[model samples]
Target chain A: MSRLTSVAGSTRAIRATHKTLSSPWATAGAIVIAALWTLPTFGLFLSSFRPAEDITTSGWWTFFAHPRVTLDNYAATLTATSGITVPQALINSLTITIPGALIPITVALLAAYALAWIDFPGRHLLFVAIFAMQIVPLQMLLVPLLRLYTGGLTVGGVAIFPGFAANSMSDGFAQVWLTHTMSALPLAIFMLHNSLSAIPTEIMEAARIDGAGHGRILRSIALPLAMPTVASYAIFQFLWVWNDLLVSTIFTTGKNAPVTKILADLAGMYGQQWHLLTAGTFLAIIVPLIVFFALQRFFVRGLLAGSTKG
Target chain B: MQAFFSWLASLPNIVQVPLVIAAFLVVVAVIIVLIEVAPRPGTAYTWVRAAIAIGFPVIALAVFGLEAGAAWVFGLGAVLGGGLFWLDARSTKGRGRLIQLALFVSPALLLLIVGLVYPTIKTIVAAFMDKTGNQFIGLDNFVWVFSAGGNGGLISLINTVVWVVVAPVAATGVGLIYALWVDRSRAEKLLKVLVFMPMSISLVGGSIIWKFFYDYRQGNQIGLLNQIVAWFGGEPVNWLQHYPLNMFLLIVILVWSQTGFAMVILSAAIKGVPVELVEAAQIDGASSARRFRHIIIPSIRPTIIVVWVTISITSLKVYDVIAVITAGQNSTSVLGYEMVRQFSLMPPQSGHSAALALLIFILVIPFIAYNARTLKRGN
Candidate 1:
């Protein structure tokens, strides 16, 4: 009777310990890390709202004691006497980003279709070659491509592509489109090919029996099924192009430069003006965040769909 | 008609750009016409059918004289012919078999020859040429890169090594830990979003934010980080100007940006670790820590390798952080930044830039090969 009683007591004690230790600690720890991770962006957001004097004088957190908000920084950024406006820069960013995002997806889709479904001689070799190109650092290609662009794709003006002179070409929206498209091609092909290949072969064969040619099969079957992945990749590529400053800076100059380049210039030229810089940075982020939330459903589904399954 | 032709001609490069596009479009239109008129073949069109199938681009180029500029006109013609081979994909076809074979492989062959194979060969040749690309330098630039006391020889090498070693390991480790810890939590989604928020900020924006955090001054504290230090009765330090640590600081920016990717990938892998295995471990008297080490780690090893190598390749090409933050000052130079600096900023020293670039390529090639091999094995 005493032994039975001891066993019951120990069982109750273990259950009680498990209950006390498990739930609250995990919840609390997750909350803490989440807060820490988000704090810098939050700080920047708050700092952007405050006036320049208030920001320089005190921390963003100090605004709780004396909350003074103003739109003067944004107003200046919009209609400055220096003449390059925020809205105009934003339009420039869109011009680069829209095409930059689209060209790769279109090209990659076709290439991926050919790679996944279409069997031909040297197909495997082609896939391997394109995949290998992914590791050729983007920076390495900058000079060679730039030189090619300027010198008419030739050796010492002996025309490789006559009338396509690099020096004659201007830094504008066109440059952004070309550079982003070329750079995006390899990864786009690799990623889309994987997603495309995951599609069951039997379904494609069935379509073929239904009298659908390769183009018809691609249109009626593969394209629709691959939409979610394509959309997700499009979002990823869009966000990348939207947020990319380095590529834009390299490919574009003068008035055609995007908001990212402008933000860099703002920080460099007017480091003291955190209020303005913060506002500018926030402006740049707004579109991307909107895009993120808009595509959140497709985003999560697409990410898991491509990487995890086949 | 004249107005339209003039407009087309004036749009861009008449020879390579516009004419090629025009020819390509015409070929596409013609293919659509053919599909409308010609009987559809069974077995999804053979090689010949496929070539003719996609021959629009080639037809467009040839019709508009775009192919005239290229050295591979005959190759283009052969590609256009290959489209006819699509009909002969099967031996039972009534069309000429020889014509079918030649036609089927033509477009891909032409595009490969003109678009890709030619340019790559040309780039290789350019790498060997002098500044004006007038004469061969005979590996002079490659020699300079490895030679002692060459400009950008040591700092770039050391910085690149530090980056490749430190960034990947740190990013992957932190990412793995975070993914493991957060895998089961209620706020897992929110945590991921917060981590990923940095990814939305353009590299330039992150650079600005970090620049503020590391903003230096001798007299007073204006930056957020410096102000916090002053609040703690500490002195403000020039974070970006400080050597060795500054490189690590730059690496932190990459870590922040890339951790989301690592976590997302590893988190998926963790979720994939079969629930039965964990239960099995528990029944065998394994503690939570032991379960993680044995069950979780072993199951996700492949994913860990993937994340590690992918991040390593990215690190090899890390330029923006170093460029925007330090601009290769205070000995924080890496290969990617040095390439830009030497070629674009410095007086067009293509040789040195190309050499530095080649080194980066050589280093990355082995990792890429390993990745490809592992992927092949996995598949």
Candidate 2:
């Protein structure tokens, strides 16, 4: 009887505190805002399935009243023609993304280890130089890179950079991967170095006293401890590479083009073709959306890392 | 050495590819042998180490091939990683630390030089050079960019200025209000996720979704916006067909995509505010609004700046949104979109395009510097 009375008293206190936060006005305001944010995507996702004529004649909201769905739009978009097929573009995206994600993370890890632990000459200057490189907009590099690929950069008719990739389309996959990896290096190094530097100096000292070399110390200690930071970056880089359109569009061609490029082209060419556009847009996002949800926590941390101060 | 590499590079790619790989492998083998035999960083071998470090890239570039640039980056990582294992076999107290730093840092440095630093200088030079780039044109490109007609660079500049002003404030405003609303609520996670879903969606996907919402028709409106207008007994409007208005609409798409980013960061900032301070204010008879203004805003000011500069930088280089929706048509163009368009033309306007690229870079510098300074203080 006494225990029950105490529980009731605590419940009353909890309600009293909670009531201050659960105001009717604030809850209703949040609901309205969330609805506004979500409804646009919700409406279009509904539109993607409606019959072509119905989508053009009626708002997607009306579909809630009179239901309809179909897969024809997806089938047509997926079916290969002279242009890109979904299968091929997915392959291209993987081809670009795998190398794009792996190369940078692997390279950044080592560079980060150097920057974080090893006391060396010019470390401060070098780290600053790399970090400063992040501000250079990639658009600045596209024209010269394209020239270097197509015409072999020349100065006074002397071949300064002999165009190495003889076939434009053949080398597009490699070009896309290399450029993404390059652009990612500065931030990757910075973030991963932050994670590496966070390890306790005493732990490192203990490892050194035990005769652990830099490589063993990194492999055993830093890598294991910094796994979360690594996973955060890996997911971030994977999604960026997968969703990337600009680098892929500029550097790649034919079969090498990512899905976003084809969809963007379809959008321009068939602007009024709602049937194709809605289906194609969803198709392009499904992979990323899945990846985003599966790794939501890591993705959030990764996205917010540099946006907030340490 | 140049002639030797040029001759080696001229061989059939099949032969050249294998030769390059074999040669790289042999060098690795030799480096390992040298490290084991001569494990000291303080000897005459220091010059030999430095020479090899410098010589590797030159040989890789001159003899290996450009296709191998990706492989070179990949192999460089492997070599350094492997070197770390080899270097670890030595004693701990030696200045072998310097050698390890050089080994690890050099590959990434080489890539930065090739990828970012060189291209930046090239683009700047291209800005001053003529369309053919045979002679210096001396501000012709800049004049073209600031001129009022064609894919009017002045128009893009104005639109960009508008975007920079509007997108960040609007996004931050919406974000701040939403952050305050859901600050410690039970539904905070769900509500925040609902808004932030758009951040994960590609800018193109968001544009397409919004495009449907803005989809125009002369008949019974299909788009939600037009439907709302029509239900109110008004004419269905082409939202993106109008100038200045279309630019704002583009800004709306950016805000929609970015507001969640702002909200997430700001909400975290708000959560960091001490509960004792807020309670103290309340006990001292501060209203909700005043409590927020005096306590919360001042606490998260750095975060607000960070979010502002980030979105501003994004707005200045805004491309994918404009590309997906209007393709920079009908006064919705930005500098980035125009740069892409100019570069892709038959007679590619490399000069003017490079100039536009440089303009975006110049705009980004101040924001980045400000961010770096503030971050330094924050840390």
Candidate 3:
């Protein structure tokens, strides 16, 4: 009883120490750091609203003195004709991201279930292999994977699998989608397996004894239990695919390019055009921002669980 | 109905995206349903399953057009469907478990084999071949990579070393400091969001934001960095044009974006540090700095290493930022950008690109090994 009281007393003391630690200096330092971190983005965001002349000539901070705002930059960026427009890139982003996120989760959930619950040969080896595959950087796979998409896989001069022929926009979408799904699987399976395997074996055994097949058990029990994890991973993968520039730049054509690709092109070709660049950047950023703020909790949970890249 | 079909076909591609995704989802739902219901004790259901499985390829062919690619899909689908039907038939006779395992696992395994594993092996092989990937020119590509000259592989190698070393350390240090400061403080959530917001922005967007900051106008200074320098009676510097400083300036963009990631992960780790240990140390008359150094750092060392390695790997693969900001000009070329640049060349130096990729893969191996060791130890 005395030991328990002593432990409680220490906890109270620690709480008091925490309060004292948050001195005025700490607060001021934090505010300064926050301002430094936020200023660049804030400047660009504010510049996106300024007129083209003002944005190019005066500092974004000068906007405080003048206080001018206009949607012309956004209008011009969305309606530009020299290249792929912002709206078209937005559509392409959705096309790539939705299926890119969904297909992997569906495939990984099944794989995770089997790895977690099924009594199978080589299960541990397979799990370890998938885990290791998570570290295989995307660069290692890009060249050959592109070949596999453009030219069929061949062994000893015999074609085993005919490659995807990108004759339409959907085919381009399919290539990007397949690439994202493949890259995302290892991490997805690892994460979902961790969560699914944590489900009590006793519950699984009880269901098995009641004559529930694996499919039924997965659908009725494991799926519901793992839905939170699945949701979090979904949000993570969605943001990842949306924010991705490397894959989309390599995979998609002009019309099928996502917003990130278009934005990169704009930044490269017209670096001096801050008005269009700023608005285009914000337009590209808006969707992920919405998803981030709306699902920040799940996103953070998934990030902590699986911190590696797709 | 005919008019409606025509209208649907005439809709813009943007409008068709949802319909396409919906169709894709329906196909996935059908597969799931087939897996669930195929084992039912009914011959009628089995026949229906077989019919639907066979009919899917036909529908795919019809929708995608009767092309050679569709023919391969048709053949593959028929074989896969037949195999599944055979398994489903035998599943009731004490083979149900194996069938379920195969059904649950084969899609993922097949995709990984075809997409990741096969391509990795092929990349390793292509690294030995010539520019056309047809001739065996062993070690030549690697020689070119390590060749010492202007904008050569050696320079890229040195820059990457600098990047991997400096970016992760600075980002992790800043993140650790921020996490410590904001621990249990008021407005913690808001403070965290300000830092973490960049994690959501595309690297492309982040580069654009920083480009504006590094923008150097000769006359009246527009860029914040230049304006501040002007305030202190300094000439406006071309931040991205200077050689060694340009590399570090590029590194700053990565640090700014990734500091949030490090902070969040380290903040979680800091929270996980035992309060009782700290209190005990306090009772022993340890100062706050001593408690932090001895207690908190040791407790979260594993997490810090993980965060550092994760960021290092990201720094190694830093492509989009370089591609956007400098396009590998001013001696800022790194392995990731060089690999893509080599591959995208007119003749397409497949061997050189492959060599660069393999180098990156080799560099990454140690990090993964360390991570695996730590994971096993933790377990």
Candidate 4:
């Protein structure tokens, strides 16, 4: 008891000393780093809201010099002008993203349940194969897919499922969905499996014994419990699909391209309206932010849920 | 040639239909059977599952012919489907098992097989063949990956090595220092948000941001960094056109974007470091630096490993930043960009590109293996 008391006393003294030593340095370092990290993003935000000419002529910090702000960049980015428009690109992005996000979540949930709870033959081997595919560079798959989508035939004249059309149904949101779904699978499966496995076995068994049935248990117990994770992965996939350039660029051609592709195209327009790219980028980020912040409570938990436990 | 032709002939008739609707069902069924029989042989349904697995593919082969019999093609698909089916079946009961599985997994699977898996197999096989994707070429393409300078071919391998080394280490170091400094501060949340802010920007946006920073001038300067240099009476350099320096600039963008990921995760681990342990160390007369090294670093070591390996894999696979920022020109070609350049975007060196991609996969395996091991052990 005397030793315990002494230890407690020492701990208190140590804590007090740590507080003294740490408070100022930690606070000062935090402030500096925070400013450094945020300044560039702030610059980006300011640039997006500024006129194109002002952006080209001065740093974003010069916004205070003008004493006023205008929405010309935003207006230019949103409206159809000179064969480019932000609103149309946004629509194209949504058409691509909604299905792109939905497909992987649905598939991974199903795959995760099996990997976690189901007793099946070759389960480990199949799991290994799925995991192995994670390393396969996504770029390696693009051409073959494009080939398959455009000119691929199993043997006869029957079109492959992702085949745009034998002649006319080519180059649109349909191709983006196909591309996004493939890339999202390995990671999605890995994530959902982690979460599903964490669920107590007894809960599943209890549902099984009560004649709750697999479908019913999944609906009532698993799905509801896993709601936060499903939402998180949905956001991640949505953001990834939205932010994608290469896959979208590869799969979709011309006007059917998503905003990222359009942004790249805007870049090539030789600084005629480079400010639109900034505005477009900001506009593009809003959906992801909404998805992320609205689900922030679940974001960290969802990301880390499958990776570790205690 | 004859044996290969015979093997091709044996694939099945569904190949003739182009769509392979029946083949898909049969393949899916075979997959379910393969999955069902693999995990728990103790289960009562093992033989039934095995029979279904063996039966469908065989029947599909017989009914359709080997011309379409590439189960190797469906092997990955079946595994994916089977895994989903088994999961659905486990949680499911009664008559609608197939329907529920189809509804839940098919939306993704149908697109995935067509988009990712099928094309991957096609590329792998194409790698073994000539550039036209006709006539088997064996190890010739693999040879070209190591050959001398030709259209930025083998140079990609070196550039990729440089990327794998530089980006992750720099990102982790900066993140660790930042995380350690910011851990208990009042501004922690704001600091993390700022660090993490870049994550919200797309790859091209990040490129544009840096492009402005590295913007060059003939004599006077307009860009931020160049202007600062001009203030010091220094000459403005075309930052993107320099060889190693250009590559380093590209690395800075990736490191900047990724550091926040490392910081956030490491911050969690740093917080997880017990207060009692640090207090104990302090009582034992450890300095702040010593306490950090002994107590905090040791505690968060597992997380550091995880972050490092994760970043390593990502750095190896990164393409977009380099693609957008430098277009893999100026000797900045890494494997990801080069693979795209050789195989898809440029003249399509399908074989050499596949070989290069395979090399990346080889390099990444040890890190991934280590990550998986650590993850399992940590759990």
Predicted structure with the largest lDDT when compared to the true one: 3
Share of reference contacts found in each model: 0.22, 0.50, 0.51, 0.32
DockQ of each: 0.22, 0.38, 0.41, 0.28
Residues B200-236 of candidate 3 have per-residue lDDT tens digits of: 9889999999999999977887799999999999989
Q: In candidate 2, what are the lDDT values of residues B274-363, reduced to their tens digit?
A: 566766787899888898799889988998999999999989888888888998889888888888888877898888888989999999
TM-score of chain A of each: 0.87, 0.87, 0.91, 0.85
What is residue B267's positional error in candidate 1, in angstroms? 1.5
Instruction: Calculate candidate 2's fnat.
Output: 0.50
Segments in model 4 whose C-alpha atoms lie over 4 Å from true places:
A1-21, A66-68, A79-83, A156-162, A167-169, A269-272, A306-310, B1-117, B218-220, B344-347
Question: Candidate 1 — which residues are off by over 4 angstroms?
Answer: A1-29, A80-83, A154-160, A163-166, A300-309, B1-129, B218-220
Model 1 B-chain TM: 0.77
DockQ of 4: 0.28
| Worst-scoring 10-residue span by lDDT in model 2 chain B | B31-40
Candidate 2 Cα outliers beyond 4 Å, as residue runs: A1-19, A80-82, A152-164, A167-171, B1-59, B66-96
How does residue B243 of candidate 1 score in lDDT? 86
Q: How would you encode candidate 1's per-residue C-alpha lDDT over A155-265 as one tens digit per residue?
A: 343343432323654533544665677777777777788778878989988887887655566667888988877888898889888987767666666566778877776
Clashing pairs in 3: none
What is the two-chain DockQ of model 1? Answer: 0.22
Residue A94 in model 1: lDDT? 80
Better of 2 and 3 by DockQ: 3
| Clash count, one per candidate | 26, 0, 0, 27
Instruction: TM-score for candidate 1, please give it.
Output: 0.83
TM-score of chain A of 1: 0.87
The sequence of per-residue lDDT tens digits that candidate 1 reaches over residues B20-101 is: 3454456444433444323444545443355554454455444433323464654655665454454444446443333322
Q: Candidate 3 residues A1-310, lDDT tens each?
A: 2322343456545556677656666667777888988999999999999999999999999888999999999999878743679988898899789888988999999999999987666999999999999777888889887877666555455444445553222334667888999999998999999889878999999998998877788889999998888999999899999999889877887877889998889888888988899999999999999999999988877887775321
What is each predicted model's overall lDDT from 0 to 1? 0.67, 0.76, 0.81, 0.67
